[model samples]
Target: MAVATGLKQEQVVAAAASDNALERLHALLTEDLRQVNALIISRMESPVPLIPQLAGYLIASGGKRLRPLLTLAAARLFGYQGDAHLLIATAVEFIHTATLLHDDVVDESDLRRGRESANSVWGNQASVLVGDFLFSRSFELMVETHSLEVLRILSRASAVIAEGEVLQLITSNDTATVEADYLRVIEGKTAELFAAACEVGAVIAGCDKQACAAMRDYGMALGMAFQIVDDVLDYSAVQAQLGKTVGDDFRAGKITMPILIAIAKGNEEERAFWNRTLERQEQEEGDLDHAIALLRQHDALDGAMDRAREWGERAIAALEHAPESVLKQALADVIAFCIERDY
Candidate 1:
């Protein structure tokens, strides 16, 4: 399928293959990431076997470790020399993993990163408890940083992420949800953590207020673009490449950008279709296919992609005053990778 970005899926894949900005960033941060990984493994250990086992299942799962990487990269961009970024990065990953565990239970999802989700294998009770453990462990790591500012940033992000999840729950299955409500949900649940991750890096590095704000802006915009594109992919063939079930959002009756745009542009019949399948939760086998068709017919997917690109541009523009360096350029490239990645 052609993305709303005017690139065919094959073209998107080829472009991603050729440029591969994420790979470049990984190469730059190889040693730092290794230390972060080691710290993560050591911190996750506990006398309670289930805590480590369940947490390790998801932690060892094939995640990109993107959030923690952002923390490390942001610090390095300011020429930070301390090992504190390593601890902060590990703490960020724990927070993220904790959220994922809670999310799978809430979504009642069966798959995560293409495998059986922690909740699916370990059950909801175990998943929630382990998630709490991870959250507690994350705060412990944060306290070790000895920076009250870092604690405040990450703790506030944790609260905001919880708020965002609650907001999403409120909006889910409600076809009447507007674009603004959707943006609020994503900004709280998704963008806040990304913003905090980057901001914490700068805070620990003692960056000037202006520089700290710039990194925060870059992360927030990049996160918004990241999530918008992820929502778009739910109806795209590319979701399969990520080992996700296509139409999982539609199946769950979650009101995403494409659905919202389609409903706005749709005829009465189309609106009723949404009401029946989404609001009413009366999905039949072919409902997902028909929903995709409507999205295409109304150019809803294109509209959503357009919004994603707008956010991507904003992320890049936020870096205008950043010092020119290979790491800085790689960070900019990451914005494109977030928007254009096929898998």
Candidate 2:
């Protein structure tokens, strides 16, 4: 699959190697996407060389630009005209990138998109400060939109994303975390921006409240499914295919849904194993293999994927009231793409 713009062919192949619907969506929006990329490049410029260097490096890291793609797709689906969507799209991208930088620093992650992370290449301090710059730039882009709701929506998302990261920090190293707590973490860290991006697409399109609600619900649900699958992939995917080290979450003691499921169904010995590895963070080599085995034995991975499928279904249902178009179908296909990620 030649995924969206801004991805290398190899990365695309590794990810959605044969997803035709995703490719069609990318092809349909090619011209508008070109404009979005131009704005992103221009806005990233800074007098400070390190800021641009680090920012540009991560920005080009070629993960799915899914958030911005959703913003653009949503706007067009609602018949948005004018170039305002371009600015909003770029702002969404900046916000997402800033969070990735902050996340890598906090996670002490060495790899991103199958390459050395910015925090690894530059220092943590540099990565953190530069993330701050990009975050500030996001607000500047939002302010240019001149829509209070747009500002309100994205500003709130930015705040919630920070809170989510903090919440994940609080939940780390604790296997006792429940499913609801895990859901809250993903909502704040991952889904809030996704919801805002799509909701703002309606804002720019001048759509009514009903359409806006539909867009927000669609994005939130899709984002929820996306993050669940992402956590599952951390434990199940090839590290190179995923563009990050597999078991990173396990090493960091992050309490995700799979672990929660396994804990719910695991025997006493399995529970102790989880507590030692995830709760106490007393992990050693071969611990990850054992953890994977436990998850499989308990069928936690299947349960997690089932939960993801439910959310993906909810996302499609949310879009039912929207008008029919190729864009609408493409957006639906995007939900399928999110749920079906194997890379």
Candidate 3:
């Protein structure tokens, strides 16, 4: 499909393939990102040593900061001039960091961003408490924006994210989960924050309702595409390039898109394998390899990637009418990057 600016899906993919789109965006928003980083560091401070110590570990860990970058770029796209975007961007990062801390604890994850996870280093209690502190700090930043609309968008996203996590917990290890259920889980957990982050930028910029809605749609679709690609990489990417082990999802019994598709396409024997490995959590030495084989045998990886690209197309389409600018083009290219990135 062609975007309002006449950019086609293939063109977006071609642009992403030719350049480091994310780096280009970071270069454009270098100053704003610097300010956002400074605000994050300043707000992370506290008299309690462990609070900052633990929170700082995860916050300073290598992350792309894509959500906050979206906020900054979106505001710039709409001609926002004031510093409110900085505070909102900082808040967006804090919220994302808090979710990471909590997710590590929930997932029993020992590593994050290729390093020891906060919960692994500091224990679950401390991680959970620091996550709470960051959540509170995020709200404080939102309040600083003084836009009730921004507060509403982010607060509701926070709640929805929690709900999504709970839903995932419910569906975990259950091979019967339909695609719709998985979509809802991701929409709440991941896409909601992305949507809120971009929408907050538009709202703070005093954009019209239609512009705000467009940004929200862009973010939500982008987030969906991003998470789907992430799930695909867990099974398809090389362990060295993937940052984490390739079979972490399999070990955890998480039912991602590849697994769901495999289950749907497999025969009775394959379903039995899933039951034994995922539902019962009785994985043997070569179970991961077997699982990977099943995925490939059924073309599950390709199927999931096709779904991701569909979301990427929707994301690009959402910004069809956005003013043609470097930032807008960067936003469009990032959709392709999210879908095409292997690591």
Candidate 4:
């Protein structure tokens, strides 16, 4: 199907090829991500030391660690040839972990990566406190880089991310929330960190402003695309791949693209069902299946998928301003993976 972004068939094929090449890029960066892991594990400490145990429990539970991997890939793409790549990579992971800790609390989530969430297992108090420790540790790692620009990039992202989380909290079940509002929230909460991840690499590599912006744009677009696809998967992916149930967003009262569009285009009876089941938060056992049917009726998932593809294309376009290298190719491949990945 042709998505609204109007990418050519070859572009889609190229994106698929890029997605396949991730195994090659993963092999290339295995050592770098491992170094980042070591640094991250070494720094998960506090004077009181309660943080060490709580943080360890969450961090040790395996995650893809994609944000830091993106940072490492960006540095490699620019031929950084320096040890700071690992430090910056660790910093990005710290930032990501901190957010996850906070996000579970905000979303009242029970499971993550097929296990109990930190907030569920360790309690919200420990999760919140440990998340603060990780954020502080991330700043410390940034200071080790001794680049004012890198610090600024991360600090601003952190602030924006906090704001995004707050915005989402306030907008829950708000039927008035539009697509643009959704974009703003995800751009701040999700994309800002991604932009900072790639931008920090350019700063570490001593790239000029233009190069830094290029990487930043690539990260932002990729992150946006990634979240949109994730929202779509909440409806489409099987429970095993998603590590969560279908209609999870509906339960959380967050109106994602598919839900929003479906609610808009559904028939009178369908709209009333959504108002009763979703807006009222009174979903019966069969409500999710009916909601899924509504999405199919409106073709909302396809629309959301198309929106994700547009963001992916924009992410690739952002790479045009970057210096061509294997690293850049790897980053491009990451963007492609964001769109094509089923989980």
Q: What is the lDDT of residue 157 in candidate 1?
A: 96
**Total residue pair clashes for candidate 2:** 1
Global fold similarity of model 4 (TM-score): 0.91
Which candidate do you rate higher for TM-score, 1 or 4?
1
TM-score, cand. 3 vs. native: 0.94
Q: Summarize candidate 4's per-residue lDDT along 118-215 as a digit string, tens digits.
A: 89988999899889989999899989888888889989999999999988887777776788888888898898998899889878988888889988
Q: Which stretches of candidate 3 lie over 4 Å from their true place?
A: 1-18, 241-243
Cα RMSD (Å) between model 2 and the true structure?
Answer: 4.6
Instruction: Give every collision pair in model 1.
Output: none
> Least lDDT summed over 10 consecutive residues: which range in candidate 3?
1-10
Window of ten residues with lowest summed lDDT in model 4: 1-10
lDDT of candidate 2 vs native? 0.87
lDDT of 1 by residue, 52-82 (tens): 8999999999888889989998888787888
Q: What is the C-alpha lDDT of each candidate?
A: 0.89, 0.87, 0.90, 0.80
Q: Using alpha carbons, what is the TM-score of model 2?
A: 0.93
lDDT of 2 by residue, 162-187 (tens): 99999999999888899999999999
lDDT of 2 at 257: 90
Q: What lDDT does model 1 reach?
A: 0.89
| 40-139: candidate 3 lDDT, tens digit per residue | 9999999999999998899888899999999998898888889999999999999999999999999999999889999999999999999999999999
